[model samples]
Target: MGVGEQLVTYVTQNGYYIWEEFYRHFLMAAYGVLFASIVAIPIGILISRYGRLSKWVLSFGSIIQTIPALGFMALLMVTLGLGTTTVITTLFFYSLLPIIQNTYVGMKSVDQTVIEAAHASGMTRFQLLRKVELPLAVSVIMAGIRTALVVGIGIVAIGTFVGAGGLGAIIVRGTNATDGTAIILAGAVPTALMAIIADLIMGMIERRLNPANKASAASQ
Candidate 1:
């Protein structure tokens, strides 16, 4: 059977728990993205504070981001060996660039006049960042995070090659069989759907936190 016909046949005839695999896949992506965000946000804020240092720091992160997923995993395995730890670590690094870059850009984009106003009001640097800057830049920060999260979903698949079991495991099995097109589709379809759904969900969050939207809401 061809890929499409075999996919239908395999799904309808089998009792395999694709649902379980889907959940695991999502769990891995979520954990990795969340962890990266926790670490990246602070680094991004710091980068913005140190303008001269920003280029070098972000460039280094961008270099790490450019590494192919499989190749990155291979390198990690040499030090960490194969497991969920290695996979999550790989995904975490992959998630950093967008999160950090977007965060810095968003924060930097805040108006200098507003910052001066805050300073005149006796706001400390921390207060200015916490109360005014972040709120205004929330949408932009989310934009970066959203990009990272979406990309992480696809990259999580490569983890399977390193024993970081995910939907990728299903695809890998298919590839090994040299005719497991159905299996590959089974994993690929769900992964694509998850990425799309996440984008819509995150985009909604970005809009909600957008300063423009808040003003509109307040006027109503």
Candidate 2:
């Protein structure tokens, strides 16, 4: 059969299953992102506030990023066993560096004058952060989140190798079957599409969150 014919047949046979697998992958990735965000954001905020700790936190997170994803997955499988737990844990760890670093940088990047103004107006530290710093930092923080989501989505596919079901199964199956085309299309296509869609959505959200910048840009 021609490549086109094979592709048609494969899609016809597994379209629903593929979609189901994609959704499962998406959910797993989302879980990983959420978990990382919860942990990373607070740590980032604290690190930024402390200043002394920011260096250590960034260094530690960078070390984690240096560990290969597959190697990390292997280590996790030994402790957590092969399942959603392992996948989520690995993905969460992988996602930490970008989110944490970006959050810290974002918060720290807030204008000093703006912060002083807030404090002069009798704003508490929390109030200064919430009303002044966080709002200004939203774009950078969201940029980190967008990066995490995209990276996490692609890496989550590796979970299938450890028995966390997702679109990775199709790609793995196709590889074992010696159907290179199937593996490529099944894995590469969806992952790329998901990343693009996620970036676009997150970009919109980041823009919406930065109303001042949005307004200024609109006026220009």
Error of 1 at 42 (Å): 0.7
Top candidate by lDDT: 1
Against the true structure, what is every candidate's RMSD? 1.7, 1.7
Kindly list the per-residue Cα lDDT of model 1 for residues 1-220, writing each as its tens digit: 6788999887777536677778888888889889999999999999999999899988989899778999999999999998778888988998988999999999999999999999999999889999999998889999988998899899888888888888888888878886887888887888899999999999999999999999999999
For model 1, what is the alpha-carbon lDDT of residue 14?
53
TM-score of 2: 0.94
Whole-model Cα lDDT per candidate?
A: 0.89, 0.86
**With candidate 2 superimposed using the best TM-score fit, by how many Å does residue 151's alpha carbon deviate from the native?**
0.9
Q: Can you write out model 2's per-residue Cα lDDT over 12-118, one digit (the tens) per residue?
A: 88789888888998999999999999999989899999999988988998998899887899999998998889989998998888999889999988889888889
| RMSD score of candidate 2 (Å) | 1.7
Stretches of model 1 off by over 4 angstroms after superposition: 1-5, 12-16
